[model samples]
Target: MVSIKEGNSPDTETLILEAARKVFIRKGYDGARMQEIADEAGINKALLHYYFRSKEKLFDQIFLAAFKDFWPSIKSELEQGDGSVKCLIRAGVNAYTDMLMKTPYLPAFVVSEINRSPERMEGLLQASGVDAAFVMAVVQRGIDRGEVLPMDPRSLLINMLGLVLFPFISRPVLSRLFFDSEEAFMSFVGQRRQEVYAFMCRAVLHSSAL
Candidate 1:
């Protein structure tokens, strides 16, 4: 039942899930096969079916885990404030960007699956209880206090997500076109904290602060 434990152990369920995530990322929903997942997990198709029943069921389990893993980091990061709106936004953006970098395929997987499966998309929305309002309210406070410009809160949140997430979503093209190597690509992304902070500041901060 526990999926956190990795490596060779008696936890067939966890081993299956771990293997399935890798296969899903590598092959995607359309390309991923149950046999491939079972092979990756070092188990036969029969054993894999015993636990997951079907590729669709296996996907649902992985998708749920993926969405569940993402939200908490966002909530924790957005909730922090370092006494300045610039710093607060910076912290949140950095945390989110870093999380995406750590899990490179997650954004792409989500983007792809959302377009391919309407039912899976609904499941993702239901499973992921991410509160956009928290970020909106925090940014709104800055606008209210005249610390930020009177931009629409929704636009601000969307812009923040785009700035941080877009790079990850388009990593293959970005890396191939601009970056010389994988390390360089990662280094470029790593530098986006200040870049995004500056972008947000110029967009919303009219004329103030460090």
Candidate 2:
């Protein structure tokens, strides 16, 4: 693939990153080889090493970026939004699904890597910079105002995340049973941008309104 450059050629780091994302997505972390990444970037292994001393480091860079896609900087996602409980849930589903729509393997990659190293969870969550208290406060306000159900904010977040990610993670199986082909499965997901938000309405919005 050609490196997307404006007037000048893409820098070596950008090429390496883009190439690494493709290989990591296609091969997963375990299966991706540094040499393969080098070839993909049209660079020699020595130069690849010069840029990223090791595969783990390169994967770390990509993994952190991918994690951001799943859960963007908490400040940006949490602070800039409507802050209503239902709107937050709806936005999360939309952001996650939209992100996965572009990179279908991201959720699977994240799940695999996290499971491969459960010890990293604490540091990863810490690195997220998301204040649980702040998010709960948002949920609490919704509850107080009767805009949200009396549920733990964390549980609601998990369920909302699952609703968005599971479809992408299960795409292959879903294709076999629910849809006739990968194309059809993705088509359904494309249509789900609004459908998933509407589903969130039932969970947080009053049933009488529907």
Candidate 3:
């Protein structure tokens, strides 16, 4: 086990973070212990503390890192492009769904932890800088451009996200409901990845046409 040394290589921080991410994903935040993280990092618990003061702090770093990874694609899509609202929505939908697929445990972890600590949600919201207003502006632009049918932007955004996220979040139940076994459900999900994008595009186009 190689330990991360201080006053030397900054690359060691990345190693610690990668190790912590693995442990957290495997054991979950609540189930993960400091000693486990230390062992995974190949460092002493004291050194772990030196890098990240507490379990909560370490988890926060992981959470923020995950959030940043998820957020930038959508934000960049919005800020860039030719100001095509439909394109923005499509890009955002793809980015968000892709992130969810890559990090399936993310939603469950964030939602559960936020539920336990309501105040944390506010900080997260502020940090992400994504609120109802921003989503609504995107939807409103689509409406103005006659690219989407008239509807409450908030409701539309919610519905879109729900359609994309609920299936993944409830994969176990959804799998059982629609398929005979877990394997079948996963296969279904793999197929639905494309289906979801197509469905979303059609739904938005249909709404705009109406």
Candidate 4:
């Protein structure tokens, strides 16, 4: 969420956000402290409180921004009939992988919260105005048009979510077991973006579509 371009001086709010993101990535929601974030930003606690009254509000702001950055504008794409289902799949997977590369700890943080309180986050997607029926209808149209295999939209969506999230969820164990170093693990993740797109294409797209 720290979107300041190279060589630009970040404003105080931007600095705070960047510092909070780093602290959240390191300590997670429960472990992160407001004072820690202020220290990370090289600012005093009073100033931090003036900008963000509470830890929850600050964390919510950062997490929500990250989520928005993570999700593609597929709703608009489908509405405009801008791309085939396969194309959308590829774009979505690419976007997801790229976002994870930038915010590697996000999936773990979300999964931890969901495990702690399932009801707390159950309505997030709905609250975001992502209509399940509308997305299903779009997928159904792809099936009717033979752009993809005749699979249930729910199954396709769940599978895509699993495929995209599993790597990040298991990164701690997988990184230790499969990679020699942090750089190697990151390199593998970078390569897996294309692999995920290709795999999903095979899983859902018709031969002609591929």
- Candidate 2 lDDT over 122-171, as tens digits, reads 87777765456766777788878777777776777777777888988877
Question: By the lDDT metric, which is better: model 1 or model 4?
Answer: 1
lDDT of 3 by residue, 1-210 (tens): 335454545665776788888787667788888888878888778877777778889888987776566453576766676665566656766787778768866666665666667787778878876556666776788777787776777767777778777876677677778889988876776666567667767777656342
Models, CA RMSD each: 3.7, 4.6, 3.8, 5.4
Listed in order, each prediction's TM-score against the native is 0.86, 0.84, 0.78, 0.79
What are the per-residue Cα lDDT tens digits for candidate 4 across 1-210? Answer: 346665434577789999998898688888898889999999888767778778888887876665555455555444455557776676667667767887787887767755766775646665455455766776788899998898888888778878988878888898899989878888888888788888888989889988
> Would you list the C-alpha lDDT of every candidate in the order shown?
0.77, 0.77, 0.72, 0.76
Q: Please identify model 3 stretches exceeding 4 Å from their true place.
A: 1-8, 75-85, 180-183, 202-210
Alpha-carbon error at 177 in model 4, in Å?
1.6
Backbone clashes in model 2: 0
Q: Compute the lDDT of residue 111 as modeled in candidate 1.
A: 75
Best of the candidates, TM-score: 1
> Model 1, poorest ten-residue lDDT window?
1-10
